[model samples]
Target: MPPLPSHEYHVGIICALHIEMAAMRAMLDEEHGTFSKKAIHDHNTYFGGQIHNHNVVIACLPAGIDGVVAAGTVAKDMSRTFEQLRFGLLVGTGAGIPNLEAGVDVRLGDVVVSRPSGVYGGVVQYYRGKSKAGGMWEPKGMLNAPPVVLLTALQSLQAEYELEDSRMPSYLAKMLERRPKMRSMGYARPEMDKDVLYLAAYHHVVGRTTCDACEVAQTLARPPRVSTDPQIHYGVIASGDRVVNDAVTRDRLRQDYGALCVEMEAAGLMNDFPCLVIRGICGYADSHKNENWRRYGAATAAAYAKELLLHASIEETSQEKPVQQILGKSSETTRSEQDWAEQFFSKKQVTFQ
Candidate 1:
């Protein structure tokens, strides 16, 4: 089939880093390349492709420029260039906030899916709202939920998993096999012994890969899994700009919002685009964070996203309103954003072709 036009794509996949975007690029069944003509105002360099039966567009934030503001800008540029984009999937890595008593034992390489579980929507801006007496943000995270088609497909996929096993294991392995260099980049799972959860009181020694130098007995012990396959956790994901490398703040997010996962970019796009967030656990939100698991985490998240989109109903997704139309932004906000973009381009001396 000939390549579809830019307007034909409804699904948009975004990543915070190049590592994450590489996995997304590998998921495309048929890559249509980029648009021959792009809007003058849209500066994003999008990769066009097909996944299952759906045509999709993918993009990643520039290097060293990530977090809420950058993520929001990427999504907005996409909606303008690909006018029919119905929703998005922010697929990347996150910090696991493990709470044994609360039954959320998120380990490195595990995938965390954002879905509405309580008062908050699927993604929560944990940094918002006023502080309560004990210092928890008031439950003012009334954010937008993911589009219904994606949620319905998730329900079906979850039910299917109960009767059978997930394809994540095979998918991840296949990615490494097909793209062998990925293994060298730490996309392959590390040894089970490498997955450690040091006690909250213990801090990192710095300039080291693991906390083995710390008190070994201070690590949190849990039951061993039957297999090396990555497990999926469905729960709320807390989003903020601050890099969470401290245990106190990580536990605080869990105690207050029941956030099984914490990430940096989801909250910025969630309110405007109302998309689902898929993240692979790179480390526990603590000072022990390292680069060891980042590649593997990004890979796992991409695998789950591909599976989720395959199960989604194309008919239902096509029927959903376009993201630009659904954003619900006021005219004043729109004008303000336009003015800012204009000033930004002017200062940078961006000349249109």
Candidate 2:
């Protein structure tokens, strides 16, 4: 393989499930370069390659927080070789916010970007420890970049498609009311089928120890940064230890938090890396989940992400060029007949033949 591009940015693309990553891989062209896969820790598969003239590394980590952390660690470590690491993007399909309509033309593919401010279990624990030790620990004061960025991106995407008022289903609403405490804590049950490797991976990744209620984990971690760009938005994302299958539970959380979307990995991955969580809405957080919509949503979001990266790369390259050269030639003179025409034109009286 040729040496990786010398650009400052090393884009990291992560998909929790194998299928989502496969779909994204198919969309990529030679402009993105070919991907090379390798075995890591003799356990999971890691796909690393270039795309869009960017050094792109794709990893479908075993599902939950721990899996995300492990993959993040690997991605971050790999970025060290580059002179500058621009950003890390988590891309894939996710369960939709409940109570939303699904139709043939709806194009369920919506992208959610996590703010850079992430809340990790370890970080939350660290602060809690400091507080217990009589140190100045305050939960309200903690802040991070990924969550903010993620939130901003979610809002922007929602507005673009006008999915702002989408809500959870009736069944999910009841579940949230019953588990009022869970609702207060921002924990929504997730829906996972046996074939859904992403949800299963999340369970395996976070493990039994770190997998706590979503609220508890996020309260400890920091949120992502809020970009001034109108394209990004910052807000709360629903995370939990279990897959939210009940419609009542999904609706309840949606109505309560006004959450833009729901997913399994954001909380887990955000727990460690202060990164972005972008989800393409696939279906409502209920039994009515549609595989076709989910796949399409994931692809749409990924395409948008690629566009963002490409634009950034072009802008960066432009800035490196000399300003004078960009202006083009200005010293050329016109024929003698044009001198008389130029003099007449100054008074706004001349008309072109």
Candidate 3:
């Protein structure tokens, strides 16, 4: 076993779900020929590749793993092996906040980027708080904002989008051409006519396969967005361990913390590493959830992430020390990431020529 060729990874993309990981992998321009060795004590796996001239790495969480502790563990290990990592991205899908007010008509499949607005940081942990009786809860701590380079890129991208529609669709189409699984109907974008915005009080029928059990008469009507492109919304994003599937709770959290989206893994990475969260809106944060649009949502987020990397000019920062200096050992001497994958599940290993 040997350490990688003293090279630094320009960026790392972290995803909690396989669908999201596949989307990120699809954007790789060239996969590294060598397989990465997993850190001795960690269970996470890593894939090496290049995207837009920068060496990039993508890491996926283990099965049934979706929370702060799990995401933080992967982020820490990734830093040790990929010492040259300047910044990271929590790229995945999240539930969208369906508030049609103040000129923000965020819809399903839209991209939500975490950005510091007012009192809240870009990412907020909804469960990191002291709960009291009478439904009173106080937030505990603040999460770290994204690195300066990434933030600058986001600002520039936002300015560009304001002038024109998002370019995610084209990028997504190209990526899908390479990775057909992502374009399957299960992961593919569903029809816009199927996009439903039910009333807050309307509850999804239990043990039903489709939304037919619920009354369409109770749906909410709102003006169609001027642009059908996946709009980008910048603001706080609520993260917690629990899956928020209730509209009442989702709206309350959005209003209380000014969260534009609700997700699960960003809280883990933000405190430990300086990274940005880019979430593709899969569905409304309500009970009528399904996987019809998950694939497309994840692809949109991944495409946006790649676009952001194009704006990042690698900074020669002094803070980055090699893994040998930080972890006291060569990462290559450890078990291979493929070995870890074999122990749990059987998925085809992504290889480079």
Best by lDDT: 1
The deviation in Å at residue 135 for candidate 3 is: 4.9
TM-score of 2: 0.49
Candidate with the greatest TM-score versus the true structure: 1
Please list the residue runs of candidate 3 whose C-alpha ends up more than 4 Å from where it truly belongs after superposition.
1-6, 131-136, 315-353
Ranking by TM-score: 1, 3, 2
Question: CA shift at 287, candidate 3, in angstroms?
Answer: 0.9
lDDT (C-alpha) at residue 17 in model 2: 68
Candidates' C-alpha lDDT: 0.81, 0.42, 0.74
Q: In candidate 2, how many Å is residue 17 off?
A: 1.3
Q: Give each model a TM-score.
A: 0.90, 0.49, 0.85
Query: Candidate 1: where is the Cα deviation over 4 Å?
Result: 1-3, 207-210, 330-353
lDDT of 2 at 94: 58
Residue 32 C-alpha lDDT in model 3: 69
lDDT of 2 at 105: 17
Per-residue lDDT over 1-353 for candidate 3, one digit per residue giving the tens place of the 0 to 100 score: 22244255657789999888888888877776444565567566777787777777788888887777688778887776666677788999998986677667778888999999787779987655554565555666677777677788888887777796666777877876776765564656777867888997787888887797789898888877665668788899998655777787777777668788988788777766778999999888788865677877898898899887776655533243332243322212123332432421222121110
Error of 1 at 306 (Å): 0.7
> Tens-digit lDDT track for model 2 on 78-114?
3333324444566776555523232111114444454
The weakest ten consecutive residues by lDDT in model 2 span 121-130
Q: Record all residue pairs in model 1 with backbone atoms less than 3 Å apart, i.e. clashing.
A: none
Candidate 1 lDDT tens digits, 192-254: 888889887788876776566767787888999898888899989988665777777778788
lDDT of 3 at 186: 60
